[model samples]
Target: MDELDEVLPPEVTATLTEQLAGWADGAVTLAPRIGVALVLLGLTALVAWMAGQVLTRLGRRTRLRRNLVDVLRLVSNTAIWLTGLLIAVTVVFPTITPGRALTTLGLGSVAIGFAFKDTFENFLAGILILLREPFRIDDTIECEGAEGRVEAITIRDTHIRQTDGQLVVVPNAQLFHNPVTVRTDQQFRRASIICGVAYGEDVDEARAVIEKAVRAVDLVRDDVRDIQVFAHAFGASSIDFEVTWWTGSLPVDIRASRDQVVAAVKRALDEAGIEIPFPYRTLTVNAPVPIRSVDGQG
Candidate 1:
């Protein structure tokens, strides 16, 4: 030790002694309690970090494991923070009672409930969403007029990827009250398209063209043999025709499929010299007869 002492600066020892003397002699006091609190915090942080690493390793294997990682992280972090807080309370107030602590906790919980009521509700909602399995990740769902594939469901909100590539976050509270429509929940969905043609166009020919268009779609269902194109209506502009098809076990890009079907029908009708007519309103008004008053003031 004496041979290794040369590395220490001479002022280091002097400063150390002066500080210790000051603490011991009551001239000054360093808060050992503060140091101890920091130590406890450091220990909790280390444990939590280690837990995170384990969870991350598991997450790499599967998507389900990835979600579990978030859950484990939350539980581990909360437990560690609670342990640190207990230690802090015990160290700061040596005479504190465990029963009194319980009472305090009860009261604090009530206050916390009032303060973070929405937060707690959302947390519980997340648990229910996971357990009940109303929908799964990547399932196409519609709620509150927003349709998309479910990106993820976290504690606060459920995220979805819209057809337009938008990220939408819907609050759990709203979900609890709102009715959700899971399109891909049963592994299939039906898509329908409405097209109008001129009255002079051959209805059978137009129907054949629509059937061909539906068939041309790669993702369109093969069992769609019940397609019917009727004289839907007599419009001020043109006749309306409806084409419907059934789909099952299809991808989440159903909108794209519908757009494709529409495009195909337009092209097919255009090639057949059939017009998808647009409404043309012509307003006619007659000039009012000149009003003549009995007094003939003009």
Candidate 2:
């Protein structure tokens, strides 16, 4: 140890020399302590990798993993890699005292923290999101005025894919503090379409047609919810009715429901000969007959 002290930094080498005695001699060969530490670190790395694989298998049985399996796989992989890194550090420097370790780590840690502040914040937010589960991975959520399916949640952000073939990434912290709508979790969501008919058309006939159309859809709920047909307004062009139906719309998959129901109702009305009234404009024209009077006299 005394001889080895010559090769090390003054502060650390003196401490190491006093503890190890002849174990770290001036020999060009490696010491048993170092060799053992290396072996332990290697074992830990292998174990960590194995644990990651096990986690992937275990996560499959979980609901979110079943729903967002890819995200779960990624999280497990990250955890294993982090554990392996920490084990490597601990094994390489076994006798580092608490105070000495802190002193050595001080500046580097501060710099690292500053550089990764946003990243760390995002990671912490992701953990909270997983734990709290405000919404699941496949849930239809509304954030920042955009609606979409939650594709994935990572350390820095949450991903969503909208109907328009756009992918949106939201910061993790915003999720913790903002209001989000989870529509997919519900058994059904109420959808309403406003339509207007000519004032002279029978409101009762229109209502009946709409109800029949809504009930015909296989996805519409039959109980605890029903079709709503009510006179919503009396406009200058026509009378309006609000047609509402409860449907098991997939989380973030609303366009399908909207298009299907609207199309069905429109077809039903067309079959029933119910007019979807349009605005009207009246025109009047007057022509002078003085030119015809001369021809009649001739």
Candidate 3:
């Protein structure tokens, strides 16, 4: 090594030595900045997590709907993380300005949005849903042929627990774009069953009997108006009566009330000797005349 250094020119060797010393000095100066940036990033993550938890707890204390609360929490966490990220980036790249940062983020976001269009669409739809409160968590809703109780509403999807015990993850865009039926919007809902009786049965009597029967069902709510029995249609074999009554709007309550009403109606009609006739058809045969053949047979 000594011989090689001696072979090189003294000025070249000194210049190389100075360049290496400068590089080493710059690296030593950069090490602490890198450490500080990492520390800031870690702190930012911790702060974001804590902010999310705090906001979630605060939201629970309010009367806000669950979906709204979740939205607020998510936004808070994102904001906290973004703040931390800005601070971390500034530490690493001191020359970066807010305008430049935003410009870069905007371009990146536009590209990401195009790539994940459906995801952003669902996210925006979810935010709207949260704000509008079309259907809150635990509310029974039907949308796009899917009916269930809302379990959760996230930025991308809605979680529904169907009546049949299946968990459905539906994109928020679908629920937002389509008509959603909030069955439990009101406390009580009207339920009706079409019942028919024999043609010979007295319409008024059948109506009275059905009103009494439906009123007797325990699940049927009587606090509303009186039970209504209207002769809705004239069937081929029987007269149809639309028996309407009020009941709780929940699926379980609706089913139970209907079951009870059906049983009561059947029992009451049987006791009254009122015949609930089955569908019947009648045939008519025309008398045929025999024709004589060409042989002139009588």
Candidate 4:
């Protein structure tokens, strides 16, 4: 300090020397606490891992849903880590007690919640979804114009593999608030298609033919539910029959059954000589002057 003062201004030298000394003393004082905090955090990591493993095994043994098990594991890890961090913090700074830490955290959480309102909403919704089991992974669902199989349900979002092979990450809150159509809620579902025949075709006969054709479809679950054919509407050219049958609930299953039913209905109608009509047109000219025959006579 005396050498620095001789070469430099006394005021600057004094201030610089004092700042360096203070920082060194502070670091030395903090080193042991920092080491202890590190050790505690290491222990926290181990405990969190152990807790996760235990929960996973317990869930499997108890035959809990996969998503529910995941939620349990996540919550356990979060709580353990939070507690461990609080303890480590208090050790590093003896001035911060658990009560004070909690109070500070509570206030911080309010700000965090406001800043991430949607995130919290999604997290809560995800928890409810896991608990309620409204739908499961691999179940096909339709919501908000997105239709697909559920791949995974995390705390913030759900992963859906769409029918066309696109992956969609949908926020959990949206699903919780809106209506979700679980296509595979049951083993089988009812599907209907309109089959229009010529207006002159017998309605009763068409209905019978359609019911028989639909029942013959390999994918149709006629044993589970009856095949139904009702005279539904009259069109410009044809009388429409509402053909309905029970089939597998999956989208692929429905599509396959529909394909077979359409083919079978067409084949049956053709064999029965029932005409599936096209629109017919009639023309009348206001001033009809002449008519020409094959020989061009008028």
Candidate lDDT (C-alpha), each? 0.76, 0.73, 0.87, 0.92
Error of 3 at 4 (Å): 9.7
Candidate 3 TM-score, true structure as reference:
0.80
| lDDT, candidate 1, 1-298, per-residue tens | 3443576666786677677887886432335665676888888889889888877777776555355468668877888787777787665566666567768888999999999999888887776676576888888888988888888888678998987899999887677768998888775566776788888888888888888887888767656545555567777667777777666634544667788888889999999899888767898769876877899965
Q: Model 2 over residues 124-231: C-alpha lDDT tens digits?
A: 787778767788777888877878888987756889888687999998888877888887878678877888877878889998898888788766675848678899
Model 4 TM-score (2 dp):
0.84
Write the candidate numbers in order of decreasing TM-score. 4, 3, 2, 1
TM-score of each: 0.60, 0.64, 0.80, 0.84
Against the hidden true structure, what lDDT does model 4 obtain?
Answer: 0.92
Off by over 4 Å in 3: 1-25, 29-50, 63-70, 281-298
Give candidate 1 misplaced runs (Cα > 4 Å).
1-46, 61-68, 91-94, 130-133, 136-139, 149-152, 164-167, 184-188, 195-213, 223-241, 247-256, 259-298
Give the per-residue lDDT of model 3 (tens digit) for 1-298.
Answer: 3765888987888888899999999889878888898998898888877877776777777766756777787787788777778777777777887678878988999999999999999999999988888887888999987899989998789999999999999999999999999998988988889999999999999889999989888888888767889999999889999888999989998888988999999999999999999855798769986889899997
Error of 1 at 72 (Å): 2.5
- Looking at model 4, residue 204 earns an lDDT score of 85
For TM-score, the strongest prediction is 4
User: Which structure among the candidates has the greatest lDDT?
Assistant: 4
Model 2, residue 235: distance off in Å is: 2.1
Better of 2 and 3 by TM-score: 3
- Candidate 1: the clashing residue pairs are 187-249
